[model samples]
Target: MSTILVTGGTGNLGALVVTRLRDQGHEVRVLSRHSPEFPVDLRDGSGLDAAMAGAEVVVHCASSPRGGDEQAAGHLIRAARRSGTVAHVVYISIVGVDVVPLGYYETKLRVERLLEGSGLGFTILRTTQFHDLVAEVVDRVAKLPVALLPKGVRVQPIAVEEVADRLAELAVAAPAGRVADMGGPEIRTLEEWGRSYLAARGRGRRVVPVPLAGKAYGGFRRGGNLTPSRAVGRTTFAEFLERRG
Candidate 1:
């Protein structure tokens, strides 16, 4: 079995990736910034070499959701390239990061480009927004008597478990460059999803559709951050909610 190194192992997706790899009988190591176990941070080159030592593959799940104008991601990719021990670098990127001109998405897009330019064998898996994200928004919107949702915003929300599975598969194999974008089985609007979630929770909340004004909201409303044609992910929103219960 190969030694798999997962960055951001404490996170929702990274933790799942490490668990799956370990379940498959592979040696799995987690890299974190402050954790005593396998302490490593991609933001800087600190402890990176030690984390990558003797590892067959490095799954780069580490990232800042808050966008920044810096070269931190590039530094990490360069370090991975220099390590020479990593056979495959599986990068988890978001769908339409390139099309959506949002700040966080811009960072993700930059990181994806850095991976491609690193010249290291890499597999980039661009996935849809997590169903958990939708659930979080639904919960917050439920506080209001009428939820203010972006009109015409479409999303194909996939489960984080499915995303972890795909990332693990990519880490175990040879780099495929860029894979087909994966999303949920169904297309939905923000309002529709929020309503369904409220109904599922036996909560009463009306969805008030409003035209998105800002750049981020505009991008979402224009469907720049969603995948419609690609419906490869098996988990649905209803399945996710049921599993949560």
Candidate 2:
């Protein structure tokens, strides 16, 4: 059995990937700040050598949601080089990250470039916004009776489970350089889904569709953050929301 090293194993996506790998019988190792506690955050490079010692694959899943500090990606590369036995590095990125100029999306794009230039065997899977995001938005909007959203913004939101499954498959496959993008089965306007979501929760919140301004808003309005052709995920927003309750 091959040994695999996972970064951010304690996170939502990373935890699923680690669990799936272990279930498949691969010897799994997780890199973390406290290798003995919480078990996630080893990209600091302190315990990387020990974490990656015998692993043949390294799945890079650690990411700052709001985005900052590109140094973390560099550290992972350094650790992999030091390990000297790593065969593949799989990176999980968001769909249309290159098109969106948002700070966090920019960071993800930069990490993709780092993977390409590192000269290591690598695979990059770009997926769409996850359905979990809907829950987050609801929670944020619940504080106010009115929620402001960008008008005409389209999104192909996939299930988090779908993204996890794809990550697991990439972790075990040969480095594909860059794989075809993946997204949810359908595309919907942000307003449409937001209304459906609030109503489902029995919340009579007013969703104001404001014309979004700035690079991030422009990109989203232009459908730069969505995947129209690579719809591979099976779960729907309605299904996900119902399941959440």
Candidate 3:
């Protein structure tokens, strides 16, 4: 069994990755800035070298929406390269980060380029929005009389378990560089997603689509976040809601 280190191990996806790796008999090291158990911060080189030492593979799932995803990723890559012990680095990224102008998405794109240029053996798995994320948004708005959503924005939300399975498989396999993007089994607008969510909850709310300006909304409207041909996930949004109940 190989020694595998997973960043953001306390997160939704990272925790699943750790579980999957351990289930496969690999020694898994959990790392995060906040988790006292691991206590390794990815934003700086602090505690990074120790995390990289003797690890054969590094699965990088650490990220932030408040910005600085690039810095966090770069810190990990630089430390790993300096340690020269890690064989491969796997990054979990979003699907539309390349074309989307949202601050978080832009940061994710920079993280991808940093991995590519680091000259380290790496595989970047670009996935769509997670099912939990969609549910959170819908749930927040469903409590209101009118559900406010971005008009024309669409997303293919996938189960985090499915994404973790794919990431764990990539961690064990030979690094394939930038793999094909993975998405949900269906394409849906945010309006439709919210409507279905409320319907499942037996709640009545007016789904209002607000036309948004800026490249972020434009990218989403143009289907930049979706891989229509690569819908490999088995869990549909409806199924996900049922499971959540």
Candidate 4:
């Protein structure tokens, strides 16, 4: 069994990945500021070397859309090289990061490039949005009397558990560089998703499609965020809502 370290082990996806790795008899170390045992922050590389000392694999699941992702990724790459023990670094990225034009997507793409040139064996898996994120958006919009959704935007949201499972698999296997993009089983518009969410919650709200400007929104409208051919995820949005209820 490999000694694996997971950054962001307390997060929605990282937590599950940690559990799966442990269940397979791998020695798992969780590196995060919130972790009691390994309270290392990835932003500044504080205490990172200690956490990564003997790790054979590092699953990078810590990322913030708010910013600082580039700095964190750089720190991680440097630390992994210094450790000289980590053989595989698995990264979770968004599916359309290269085409999406959003600031967060750009940051993710930059991080991917950093890992590619870090001289370390790495695997990058780009996946569609998670069901939890979509649910959160719907919940936020439902708070208002009229639910506002982006016009002509479509989403293919996969389950966080499925993504975690995939990450765990990659952590134990050989580094395959960039893998096929993983997408949800179905692609639906924002209005359809919002209506499904409202119906599942037994709420009656008018779903309004608001036209959003800018290249980012246009990218979304053009389906830059979707991978119709790679719809490998099994759980649909409706099923995700049912399971949560």
Candidate 5:
């Protein structure tokens, strides 16, 4: 079994990836500032070299959407080189990241570029929004009298576990550059998703659609966040709701 070093291994997707690697009998090293396996700061690079030593694969799941995602990826790339034995570096990215004008999305694109030029065997997997995020949005809107979402924006949300499973599979296989995009089985607008989520949970929140503008929202409005052609995930939002219930 290969030793895998997972950055951001304590967070939602990263935690799931860690579990997947462990279940497959791989030696998993979790590198996060607060991780129980190995406490390392992705920003400072403290303990990162040690965390990556002898690791056969490094699954980069760490990201800061608010900002600094590119910086974090750069740190990890340097740390991996210091270790001198990492055979592959797998990066998790979002669909349409290059098209999105948001700061976080731009940061992800920079990381992709960094990995491509790192001279390391690397694989980048861009996936759609996760079901957990969709549920969270519904819950946030539930706090208001009416569930409101931006207009003209569609999302293809895959199950977080499914993405984790795919990452694990890639971590163990030969590095393939920029694999096929992974998407949910269906695509729906934000309002449609919010309404269905509330209806599924038997909540009575009225779903309201609000117009969105600006370059940031422009990408989403034009379907930048969707990958209908690659809708490979089996789980649906309704199915996710049923599981949570």
Candidate 6:
């Protein structure tokens, strides 16, 4: 069994990855701010060296949409290189990071490039929006009497469990830089998702499509964030809701 280190191991996706890796008989080290054993913060790289010690593989699942991801990734790469034992670094990124103009997407793209040039054996898996995130967005918008959604934006929400499974598989395999994108089984508009969410919750909120003007929104409307060909995810949005209920 190999010694693996997982960043953000307490998060929704990272926790699952850690569980899967441990289930496979690998020695998994969880590095997080709240972790009792390795309380490391990725933004500043504190306590990372100890966590990196003797780790053969690193699954980088820690990310912040509010910024600081690039810094965190840089620290991780440096720490892994310093350890000299980490052979593979697996990263989870968004599907439209390259095409989308959003700030957070731009940050993710920068992190991907950093991994590509870091000289460490690395694998990057880009996936669509998670079902929980999509559901959260719909729930937030549906709070008021009228739910305002992007006019033409589309989303392919995939289950975090499937993503965690894929990441866990990549964590142990040979490094193949920039793997194929993973997407949900269906591609639907944000409006439709919102409507479905409302119906599922038995909420009588009306979904209204708003034509938000922005390059990022334009990118979303053009389906830059979708991968219809890689719709290998099995759980549909409706199924996700049903399971939640």
lDDT of 4 by residue, 1-245 (tens): 99999988889999999999999999999987877878898778898899989888999999998999999999988999999998889999998899989999999999999999999999999999999998899899889999999988999999999999999999999999999999999999988998988888999999999999999999999999999999999998888988998
State the lDDT of candidate 2 residue by residue for 122-188, as single tens digits.
9999998888786677568657878877799888889888777888888899999999999998898
C-alpha lDDT score of every prediction, in listed order: 0.83, 0.83, 0.88, 0.93, 0.90, 0.94
Q: Is candidate 2 or candidate 5 better by TM-score?
A: 5
What is candidate 6's lDDT per residue for 92-160, written digit by digit as tens? Answer: 999999998999999999999999999999999999999999889988988788999989889999999
Error of 1 at 34 (Å): 2.9
- Lowest summed-lDDT stretch of 10 residues in model 6? 32-41
Q: In model 4, where do residues sit more than 4 Å from their true spots? A: none
The TM-score of predicted model 4 comes to 0.99
Show the lowest summed lDDT stretch of 10 residues, model 3: 35-44
- TM-scores, all models, native as reference: 0.93, 0.94, 0.96, 0.99, 0.97, 0.98
Give the higher-TM-score candidate: 3 or 4.
4
Q: In candidate 5, residue 47 scores what lDDT? A: 81
Model 1 misplaced regions, further than 4 Å:
68-70
- Kindly report which residue pairs in candidate 3 clash with one another: none
- Model 5 scores a TM of 0.97
Clashing pairs in 1: none
What are the per-residue Cα lDDT tens digits for candidate 1 across 74-159? Answer: 66666676777777888888998988888888888877888788878889999999999999988887788888887888889999
Scanning candidate 4 in windows of ten residues, the lowest lDDT window is: 34-43
Please say which candidate is ahead in TM-score: 1 or 3. 3
Expressed as tens digits, the lDDT of each residue in 112-170 for candidate 5 is 99999998999999999999999898899789998888987898999999999999999
Alpha carbon lDDT at 153, candidate 4: 97
Error of 3 at 35 (Å): 4.5
- Checking candidate 2 for backbone clashes, the offending pairs are 32-40, 32-41, 32-42
